[model samples]
Target: MKDKFEEAKPILTTLMAAGHQAFFVGGAVRDYLLGRESGDVDIATSARPEQVQALFQKVIPVGIEHGTVMVRHCGESYEVTTFRVEGEYSDFRHPDHVSFTSSIEEDLSRRDFTINAIAMDVEGGIVDPYHGQQDLRQQVLNTVRDASQRFLEDPLRMMRAARFVSQLGFRLSPNTKEALTTSRELLKEIAVERIAVEMEKLIAGRYVQEGVELLVESGLVHELPIFRNRNNLVPVLESVTSRPLQDMASFLSLLVHYSTIDVKTFMTEWKLSKATKNKAHTLLDGLERLSCDPLPYVLYRVGEELLDSFRELMDSVGYDQLHPKTSVGKLFKELPIKSRADLAVDGKDIKELFPDEKPGPWIQNLLNDIEYHVLLGQLQNDRNTIREWVIEWNPHDPS
Candidate 1:
């Protein structure tokens, strides 16, 4: 299990051999202790950013000003940050200034949560100045210092606290929860992009329902209109927990079942990109149709991309129990029509056949008829057959 840590050992050993103190820190250490695979290994070192860059041949000054440098080795990148203490935070997002220090304990004291403050030396073992292991054993999240002061330093930490609770399935200490509730309004002082990232993580966490309930309880939902009445999200949480969804679009679609806001309004509130909004809406629209009896027309209209999304939603919503009559699993396997592009004819063919006739509703009507014929297997999807049908058909004459 620890073999995975071997990849990062060389980098850590290299820095430490150069008369610098380096240790694995932050979420990676927390995850390692939780018996989960850590995605990224972050190293905290007493060396300054310039010293870190000089120690590694390939270095990226990603956040050098904030005492962070990216070191790449063996086709992987690790964020190596100097042990630094932050000054006062007036803007509620960034520190007014940071002073690099040589003590890892001082650096860990300024962290947001106790669990994240623990650091592990490659050979010397764990350095837990804040008793983070105790909190991890108790399944509690507490700030390293005063919760209010920590939140005031960077308001995003409040959201991060809630997100970590969701991610780790831990309860926030009483003081931490109170601090988050009191400082909820300060979330506005943070950037929308940062808030959105944390919100998405919160929603996707294993204990999402608990996280959202905390958001409402802390009055954080009121500051962001998109999250207002998010208490109604209980059903959404229930639907998604059955099957874990990693894609953001699928997760947002599940919320549509609980939200009355239009896609545009929801996206505007969350500051989501146009592509994300479109995909989420399409997934929601497909799920709504999935509630009805399986329809070839619906399948045809929704096509493959949305059909896959609907399948994921069905699995999430307990499709086996909730939709026994609806054979989503089977229907998904046999999608009748994949897309409009798969149709044999085009607008140009329709225009050529009816050159004398003006382009109008009749053209669409003929195309619909052809699509129906193809869907019903009554006609082969060939240009000749569709063109012949168009030639024989009379728009003004009734059948």
Candidate 2:
């Protein structure tokens, strides 16, 4: 079969004709060599960013300062970056400066790992200056150059190396592993958002157990204030191998495993958005309740979004597959209260019966009672009967 390169050939030819050396580069080349479908096609060229912009009518200067541009062709956008050597990384993230160079070898040398450093020229063929092909064939993760220097230049690359191990099911070379363990402290200089994104990918990977084990072994897990109780994560990692996680929230719940302090502290320390924090809390709550007999009230309280998350959580922990007979599965099928909108009566209907009563706490209390009744399956969901019960309902009367 003709690979994804067929779709990108025309663009490569166009740039080549313009007196620029264009070739498919980065993860695309790695994936192609590994017999996997490439997710995105990245092109590297000898031409500067401005030259690329001039060649394409609809060029987007997405990272122009860094000699990168997005060229639109055939209704698709392809990232085209000029081969460049980076300067010292003062921030341990972005380089202090970047200089476009003509030598592709120089550009490849600056990359984080040998596997990711390989590039392929469309006509000239693969460029393996660092023997990345050998490393790939060996199924090992090795650094392109000095591991400490490379990781110190950008600490996130250390985590990324581990992530690639998890993602590609590869083993880290001894030297590479040592470098990661030594460089674990450098992660403190990286941003939370970058750390969170890598963590999510690492946990979601097929070999998450390996990646997480590496993190803990390298002492990177304890560096994060939220992961101080790293021991709790062992069971969580064991759980994730069974079921694929639906989203980050479910993954977070598994990582924390019902630890109230860890969850709250991690969320706050990571500066997670309020929406994400709430979702993570909901997943944890559901998982905690499901650890025992799955209860209808628990399902009603957790809602459908969380119920789905709970199923994923169970699967991640290597529990029995969530079949229809499972308590969670059954509760999912028979959620008596689908939504607040499913309540039998509304405020307006209650108002009509008790015209003298103002819409206040009592009205909300009656709705809550009706919702509880619907959830318990005690009463048929009818507006007339619900309204009658609301009229006579007295909070003060215990009987």
Candidate 3:
């Protein structure tokens, strides 16, 4: 973890060289102690945002009002935030105001979780004011202060707790778990977009089952619109507990499992993208009769793009066994006509063969018929065979 921090350590060195105090902070420091390679290293500094910008050549005022600035140093970007105390958070999201301070203790105190609140210097000197190190070692997700007060400050902290539990395979402390259950409704005050983001990460985590259990046990899943009335919620979660779902789309299949609900309506309620909604629909739709040894027709129906994700979902949930990944790749690769575009004769070829016939939806219809025949092995995927077949099939026309 410290080696991962080496790339961005120069930023702290430069800040300190300019008569300011800077240290590796947040996830970077915490990950370093946990011996995991951390990404996007962050720094806590006594210097103001403008002071950080002045010291660095490429600085982005990403959240200057919140005492944060993106500093690009040594070909890496680091978020340098000033030590500060936050004002009341009325919206359960952002604090109304923040006052910059020289005390790192003040900044660490405001963080959501104890493990995330730990700070470390360049030489690996740790400042564990909240005993984040102890919590980290204990694999406990403990909040920095009275859980309810902190959650009252921002309810999304509850979701973050769930995500950390899944990502780090940690358990929530008794008080933290109690506060989360009681204040789960505060998530309503947070935005759906934020909740969706946390849910996505939570389901994609290595310990996703644990996270889902926490979501169920903590009663946090009820706060989200998409998960409010799910029947057989345990089975829904158990479906994904086999292993981490590949992505949000795969995770979504588990969400809509065995429920007497319209999938599109459920997805729309969650504000998912058309592509994601379609993938989830396609993947789930295939699962109805999907088997380990699907016939050629079934493979053709699933299409080349979605078959893999379908297989991934099936294998992840232990619903069915899948052949080797290459099996589908080779099967699709060898298909005579994999899609409409692969048909031997397209709309243009069909129109050229029947110059006297006026074009209508028939061109597409004929192309579909040809593609279907090619996939069924009843006709060859050759331009000449398809043209002759089309002219013979449409024998009423002059030929």
Provide the TM-score for each candidate, comma-separated.
Answer: 0.86, 0.86, 0.88
* Residue-wise C-alpha lDDT for candidate 2, range 216-324, written one tens digit per residue: 6788777654665566655545555444466667766777773444667767777777888889888777667765734676677677767777766766554555444
Tens-place lDDT digits, model 1, residues 87-156: 9999887788999999999999989999999999886388999999999999999999899999888989
Off by over 4 Å in 3: 1-3, 230-234, 288-308, 316-319, 322-326, 336-339, 355-358, 373-380, 389-399
- What is each predicted model's overall lDDT from 0 to 1? 0.78, 0.78, 0.80
Cα TM-score of candidate 1 = 0.86
- Report the C-alpha lDDT of model 3 over 132-180, residue by residue, as the tens digit: 9999889998899899999999999999999988888999999999999
Better of 2 and 3 by lDDT: 3
Clashing pairs in 2: 239-316, 239-317, 240-316, 243-315
Query: TM-score winner among the candidates?
Result: 3
Error of 3 at 189 (Å): 0.8
Residue 35 shift from truth in candidate 3, angstroms: 2.7
